[model samples]
Structures are given as structure tokens and as C-alpha cells.
Target: MTATAPLPDTAGLRSRFDAELANFLDRQDPDWPDGAPRGVFRTLHRFVLAGGKRLRPLFCYWGWRGAGGADGTPIVVAAAALELFHAFALIHDDIMDGSERRRGEPSVHQLFADLHARSAWRGDAGSYGRNTALLCGDLCAAWSDQMFHECGLSTDEVHQGYRIFSLMRTEVIAGQYLDLVSGVGDGSVASALTVIRMKAARYTVTRPLQIGAALAGAGADLMTALAAFGDPLGDAFQLRDDVLGVFGDPAVTGKSILDDLREGKRTVMMALARDSADRNQALRIKTLFGNPGLDADGAAELREIIVATGALDRIEQMIRVRTEAALAALEQAPVVPEAREVLAALAAEAVDRRL
Candidate 1:
């Protein structure tokens, strides 16, 4: 099987982690302070390449390929930049969410904090860890900017990519604010949908693909096709995330169970639960969500109630429907079949993963 193969299937793109990432890391260090180690680069590299879906890069590549771009080198490097950017976001996200793990491993900040605790850092160990990780996250973000600029794409394309990245940053930050507020009961489902579109769906899936298409010199028509397909597919992506946030395994997913509930996230599941439930059920939800003190049995009971109320089944159906809709959108798209393979596999497998 090639590197970009489908889940539980054979054959895929060349694994960009080793060769491509090594080259990317070379550009990161002009010089290292003796004995300090390239701690930042090493840690960021591990985090970025940590057994992941490589979804952003793959989305970017397939987007370019779908648009008939011959310049694979530029796109691959550009795609790598996307993954770097995602790592930057996730580092900060784990910090904000107080999430202990990522992709079934210690979150960068948590890892640093744990190390600091063991080694007797000067200040508070957790603070030391958080601050260090924050700096590293910024460094990684800067490296992404440098990578895209130096990826050998046209000047115009590079500038356009920067512009999109800027827009994405602004939009996702706003979306995150809305999401945070919504969890506290100050926002509505409409707002949650908006957040979903701006934050998770677009950056995680849609925009990366669009970036690839743009780099490929796709015309307005193809851009429209991509946008048309990106919106709903992105929604499905976030929806699955919501499901996983509630139901996924801690070990396999590398995130704590009921994380979204504990965080009081305004997911589609939460929204549906609120709308369909009785006042008692709603009170239970409100009381349980984001309660860090809630025990495992309490969480399990909540999950049971959610399932017994048919909410879990309802959410599953939504996933299935959204999955079909994404497939249909792809069918309607005017792209080469081979190019579609990676994306279709990603979309399907994102939801199909055991976690």
C-alpha cells in the first residue's frame, strides 16, 4: 500500500512525515543554543507527525490534484505547512480546553508540564510547561508562514494563501468565542452552526482543499464546486467530532470521555438534546455538562440517558445522512476520479475510526 491508502484498505500517497517533514525541520533551525537541544523543533515534530490522519495535507493535495495542477512539489510543501498550522492551533486548543491528551498521547503543554514537575522547574511547573508550549506553538505557527512563502509557488499564489490564512485565523477565533459563549447559555443553535462553519469545518477540511485548488490555478467555476462541496462536508466533519467528543474512547481517541460535556460544548448533539428533552432532562444536562467534579458513573448515566432517549440513534442517522450528502456532492463535482479517492476516504474514515 502506498502512503495515502484508505482505512483498513490498501494504497495511498507517499508518507510525507519522514522525508518532507525532515526537510521542513531543516528550515526551522538557523542555529541552536548549545546543550539546550532543539527542544521546540523536536517536540513540534513529534506532535505534528504523531500518528495522525494527515487530513489537512491530504485535503490540500487532493484539492490541487483534482484541479489538474502539475506542480506537485509546491503543493506538497504547502500542504505540510497546513498541517504545521493545525498543530499550532491544536496546541493552543489543548491548553484552552485543559485537555490532557491529543491523538492518544500527552498534549504538548501537558507533556512539558509533566517534565517540569519531574525536573523541578523554577516557577510553578504547570505554568512553566504552559508558557513554554505557548512559545513553541508560536514558533511552529511562524514556521508555517515561512514554509508556505518558501514552498516555491508563484508569488501571487503565496500571497493569496497568506490572505486565506489570515481570514481563517480571524474567522476561527470569532467562532471559538461564540462557541465558548454558547456553552454558557448566552448563545443559540444558530450561533453554534455558524461557529461550526467558521471554526472546525472550514479550516479542518474545506479551506485546506480550497488552498490546494487555488494553488492549482483553478478557475472560478471549480472554486464554486469546491465551496459547494466544502460547506456540508465540513459540517459532517464537525458533527462527527461532536459525537466523538461525547462517545469516543479515551485510550483510542486520546481524549477524556465526556470532554465536550464537561466543557459544556454547544455541539449539534447538545442542541438536539436540549430541544428534544424534558425540563428534567435539560436540567440534568445543564447540571452535568462541564462539571469537572462529575464522576465516571454520573457520566455513564448521562450517556445512558442520551442513548435511551433515542438521541444517540438520532445523531447516528444525522451522520449517515450527512455522509451520503457529502458523497453526493463529490459525485456532482467535476474532478478526476483518482483525485477524489483520498478525500472520499478521508471523509468516510474520519467518522469510521474506532475512536
Candidate 2:
């Protein structure tokens, strides 16, 4: 067999992505028409650059390589565009969830709200903040599209990828809608899994991978193979995130451990816990799980209930199974050996993380 090439430098790629993102933002007209507020642009700059795992871009880059696309500026710029879209999703999601922090800093809406309060602005601070943040999210979405199209790739490659990009966007929005309804609807594991598949699974991993592969003119079979690998990995990824949301340290996660419980997110873990809870445990969960004013004691009780119900253990098992399935799929996928090795490592990192 021919010798496999060495693995690409992921840390260097991450730095390049960050630099490309910063440069793209810097090129935008932050100050326009003499009266437009620059704070929105400045905030977007900080929020995008502040912190992120950059999982989406890395997946995209690997997918490109797996499909025989060469390393170059075009792929890097295109992959980085995904980060802008992620910022849009996160900014909006935080507003919907009423989250106070992200990546160890004030969330976009909270920052704007605090600014309004501190400036003693004429409008309701909360409303002003939400509205401004909404605009900022919209701006990020627009920028993502612009950056992707202008990434210096051939028109055919960009066009192929845009189709997948559009579908990913639609699916995530639909999933978000389902998530809102699921909070009031039956909290079944099936429904929760549906949300994961659409909202996080496909959006997070599968679509990014497919978009990259498509850009490289990959055939349908390879695209399907990447999906097989990405879907399970993405499921495991979200499940781990759910665990961290409830159990992770704020200093480590840069998010409040209480926020998930407070929002009563209809996660698979919560659904499983509800399914297995005992009588008093069920009652306590009903009382405290979604309570906006849930305190430390209530959160502690909920954690105990989740553990006693065996929900935590079940979720962990699910994560392991899905992670294994993803790796198995990756092994069979018709990708370069170097890509396969790196992807297997990524799968482990995705499912086994404190953050």
C-alpha cells in the first residue's frame, strides 16, 4: 500500500480560521452613513472572535480533504464562514433561552441590555437589548453568506456548497421551532431526539461535512458516507453538551450550569429522567426543573433525581454507542487515511469534553 500522508496541522488551521474571520470583519464598513451605530459591529467583532470550539470549520476542512480537495486559502475562507453562521445561531439562541453568559462572557443580548441600562437609554433596557441583538444576529447571517460566496472558490464549487448550506439553515430553524413547541408538548425521548437530529446533529456536523465534500465535487455515495459518520458523532456531541449544561463547572464551560435546568430544555437526558423518575422525584422535577427562580438547592435535588433515575448513566451509554458508530462509519468511509485518523480523534474530543 502507498504510504499515507502526514496529518495536517489542526492548531495552525484554527489560527488561520481566526485570522480570516478577523480580517473579514475588519473589511466590513462598521461605520456607515455617518449615523449608524458602530457598537453593533464592534460587539459582533468581539463576540465572534472571543471564543468558540471551531468544531464546524474543522469538520468542513476535514471533509474537504477527505474528498481530495487541496489545502488553500479558498477552503479556509469558506470553512470560516460557517463560524459566522454559528455566531448567528448562538446569539439568537441565547436570547430565546435568556442565557446570561456564553464563552465566559456576557451574551450578546445581555451586553446590549446592560449597555442600555448603563447609558440610561430612553427605551426598556431588555427590549432594546433583544432587538439590537436580533439585528446583530441577522447581520452575522448575511455576512456568512457573503463570506462564503466571496471565498475565492470557483463559482461551481461555491454553488454546490450553497445548496447544502441553505438546507442546513432551513433545518436548524425548523428544529428551533420544534424545540419551542416541545417545551409545551409531550417531553418524549423521540421528540427530543428529533430536535437533536435537526437542530444540532445535522446542523452541527453532517451538513458542514457535506458542504465541504460537495465543494470538492464529491459524488453522492461519498456524501452519504460522510453523513453516516457525522450524524452519530453529532448526536454524541449534543448529548455530551446536555450533560455539561447540567453538571459542568461554570468556570470550565463558561456557561451557567443552572441555565439548562432553568430553561427546562427538552433534552434527551431530561426526557429519560422524566420517564424513569419515581413518584416524589417526578413531583419535585415538575416543580423545579423549569422554574425560573430555581436555586442551588433545587438544582442539587434535580441532579440527584436525574442520577437516581439512571438518566445520566443512560445518556452516557447512548453517547458511547453513538460515538462508536460514528467511528465505525468513518473507518469504512472512502476517505484518505490521514483524514480518517484525524476524524476519529475529533469524534473522541467531541463526545468527551468538560466544555
Candidate 3:
């Protein structure tokens, strides 16, 4: 039996990641565009620096370590680039979803909207905010590429990492488009799973690991092994996120429960519930699920339908199964012992957390 190494100091990684972001942001000449509004920079900086679990960067770090890379600034900077990409994703996602809050604060678009309102800006306040936020998201995506390229890795390593990074960016944006289209028609578990695979699983976990491994000059076989572990774990993470979106406490989750129901998120849980619900139950869900003005009473009914149809239970089971699969893969993977230990713990935290 292989002995798993003790978990590394993740808190230390978090601190270093935070500092890297701050230093990078500080060095940027916010006034470089001359007369262009500075608020966009400030907003992006705040949004990026603000509260987040920094999960992707952590995964990248572990992947690099697992691939036998020594602890160094270059790898840390490379890993931190994933966080910038995630910030881009979140900013765009909030705009697309019309989410009012993120991490217990006003979302980027909402914050800018409020700014427009306060200043009595000409034209539509909401439109101005949305447009500005969109530009900011674009900037973040561009900056992510820039940071990833600028990291002090060998030319070959940088080239390899970029291949993975570019693919990740493309797939995630495509997945977002698919998610939007999926909301238009009858929700199917298959469609939802497709979105999860592209947007959540591959972008969130698999590719980050691959990118880090690439930076470490890991070969094809090792990359395949990491994907085997990462993909399933990512699925379980997103499934847990789906459950939390509807059932989790807003105070803890830092998101309103109503947002998912109001947006009619075509999550697997909703698909299963819709599929299994009887006539009236289905009708009740159909009527209330997407209603923006749906109140607590309607939400109670919707929750009841979800529970009664056993979708919630089934999703829980799916999380467990996928998590176990990820852990089992880790055991057989060629990653360094410490990476196995940390990745194992991360799998549990990703699926079993309340927030």
C-alpha cells in the first residue's frame, strides 16, 4: 500500500495567491487609458480580491506539486492565473444570470448599476452598469491570458500550459452558451450533465490540473491519470453546488435560494424532479419554478416537489458515488503522495460543504 503524504499548508498557498494578485493589480496603471473611467479597474480588482475559496488555484498548485515540481514563484504565479480566469467566469456568469449578490455583497453589475443610479448618469442606468461590467469581465479574461503567459516558466512549459488554458477558456464560454440555450426548452438530465461536464468539471477541475501538470512537463499518461481523478470530482462539486443553490441557507451560501429557481436553472436535480413528479406536482413545479416573483410559499411547494420526487436524495447519492470514484482514482494515480492526500480532502470538502 502506498502511504499518502500529509496535506500541505493550503492556508499558506491562499496567502501567497492573495499577495500575487494584489501585487499584479497594484502594478497595473489604472489610469493608463487616460480619460477612461477608472471604476472598471477598481471594480475588477475588488471583485477578484474579494471573498472566494480560491479552489481552482489550489487545484493547480497541487497538480504541479503532484507532477514533481518544486515549490517556486513561477509555479505559484502560473497556478494563480487560474484564479483570474475564474474571476472572469464569475463576473460574466453573474451578468448572464442577473444575480444581484455574490459572496454576500452586491455583484459587479449591480454595484455599477447602483453607481449609475447614484450619479444620475445619462442613458439607462441598468444598461450602463451591464455594459461596464461586461467590459470588466472581458478585461479579466484578457488579463488571465496575459498573466498565464507572463509567468516565468520555460518556453516549452509556457507553450504547453497555454494549450490547456486556451482550451479551458473556449470550452467554458461554450458551456455557458449551452447553459443559456438549455434554459429555453424542456430540461433534460442529459443536457444538464453536458453543461456540467464542459463548464464545471472540465473547466473547473480537469484542465486546471492539466495546465499545472503541463507546466511541470508531465507526460501524456500522467495527464490522463489526473483527468480521471479531476473530472468526476468536478462533477460532484457542481452537483453539490446545485443542491446548495436551492436548499442552502443564504447567510451561509452567500446567495439567495430564489435566484436558481427564478432563473429556472436547468440543473440535474430539477430535471430529475420534473421527470419523476406526478401530474399535479409537475404542474406546480412548472408554474412556480421560473417565476421571478415566486414567494416563500411557492418555494416551499417547489421544494416539496423536489423532495417528494426523490431528486434531492438521488443527487446526494450521485455526489457520493462520484466522490468515491475520484478518491479511488487518486489512489491509483502517479501523483506525488502529498498531492493525493490534499486532493482527497478537497474532494470531501467540495461535495460535503454547506457553502
**Highest lDDT against the true fold, candidate:** 2
- Each prediction's Cα lDDT score? 0.74, 0.93, 0.87
Report the CA-based lDDT of candidate 2 relative to the real structure. 0.93
Candidate 1 lDDT over 149-226, as tens digits, reads 888888987776667667767777777776777766644556777879887888877788788877776777877787
TM-score of each candidate?
A: 0.90, 0.97, 0.96
Which portions of model 3 miss their true places by more than 4 Å? 1-8
Ranking of candidates on lDDT, top first = 2, 3, 1
Which parts of model 2 are misplaced by more than 4 Å?
Answer: 1-7
**Candidate 1, poorest ten consecutive residues by summed lDDT:** 1-10
Summed backbone clashes in each candidate are: 6, 0, 0
Query: TM-score of predicted model 2?
Result: 0.97
- On lDDT, who's better, 1 or 2? 2
Expressed as tens digits, the lDDT of each residue in 116-143 for candidate 2 is 9999979799999899999999999999
Candidate 2: residue 229 lDDT (0-100): 99
Write down the lDDT that model 1 would get: 0.74
Q: What alpha-carbon RMSD in Å does predicted model 1 have with respect to the real structure?
A: 3.7
Stretches of candidate 1 exceeding 4 Å from the true structure: 1-14, 33-37
